[model samples]
Target: MDLAARSPAYEGLAIELAVEDEGWHDAGLGDLEAFARRFVEAAARRAGVPDDVETELSVTLTGDAAVQALNAEWRNKDRPTNVLSFPIRQLQPGERPGPLLGDLVLARETVEREAAAEDKRFADHAGHLLVHGMLHLLGHDHIDDETADAMEALEIEALADLGIADPYADAPEHL
Candidate 1:
């Protein structure tokens, strides 16, 4: 599937996609951009943002070490999580020409491991995580059960729109 034509909802959002991993040669650039765009568009829609509204978003795919450092520096965690979102809040509504949504960081190893554990394809799992992270960037969080439920529901619907199966369908033993 061509990433450019997949999501009509994010036609105006400017996405900066970066692949920081040497091991990610197997994944196509267009495929990654498509997944990231899908996630961003879905999250924005859920947040009531206009599809045509200009927004700037960045996504980076990297190995465990880079993500681990980001996790430690920003979240105060010693190890890398599956993904991390850093939303840019300093941009004023009128002062900024367009919204700088924020940044998303994904860990390659953790993503692969989770995909395998869930008995799903790596690309699908990556898409799910990207959506989850984008939601967080848009100020959606799971701090409480009610919020978690709402967020998860949105995630399910978003992933489904991408033809990905419900990521939470078969709960892992750890859950």
Candidate 2:
């Protein structure tokens, strides 16, 4: 069965956490609910989500099977990715967000594998992913070189604020 938690706004954003896979509960991540709240809220602030918008969003921690299904249905990938963001509506940068933002779904196995491969602490990697997903929910994309650079910069700044190492530090610089 899924375990869920919902609390009042954290600086104008209400974040709900739902653990859909037992592995998440057993992952020894230390308070996934609080982690999600803190990272997403910080991301919203960093991405200029507007403190007065009174937004709401959900994060689901699940396994690859579920994520694969979602990916196939929504994105037609037929594979499990680390995280997926499903936004209620796409907003332009600087556009005021709304009461309902979007949902972020993460796969536990994929996240763990990625963390181990990248030599990152699981929590730090997950936190970075949360920030990335939050940016996507706010309509930030890396579709073009310029936009990718801007989004990556915002992600680095946001993750730094949360005390996470820059996820793209080792990535080759854009030409």
**What's each prediction's TM-score?**
0.84, 0.90
lDDT of each: 0.76, 0.85
Cα misplacement distance, residue 21 of candidate 2 (Å): 0.9
Residue 33 displacement in candidate 2 (angstroms): 1.4
Candidate 2 per-residue C-alpha lDDT over 152-171 given as tens digits, one digit per residue, 9 for 90 to 100? 88889988897888888775
- Evaluated at residue 37, the lDDT of candidate 2 is 84
What are the per-residue Cα lDDT tens digits for candidate 1 across 1-175?
A: 9977675765778989899996665754357776678777765666557666777888999989999998889879989788988888633212322568788888889988988977888888787888888777776777787777777888888877767788888864211
Question: Which one is best on TM-score?
Answer: 2
| Best candidate according to lDDT | 2
- Residue pairs in clash, model 1: none
Q: Show where candidate 2 strays beyond 4 Å.
A: 1-9, 172-175
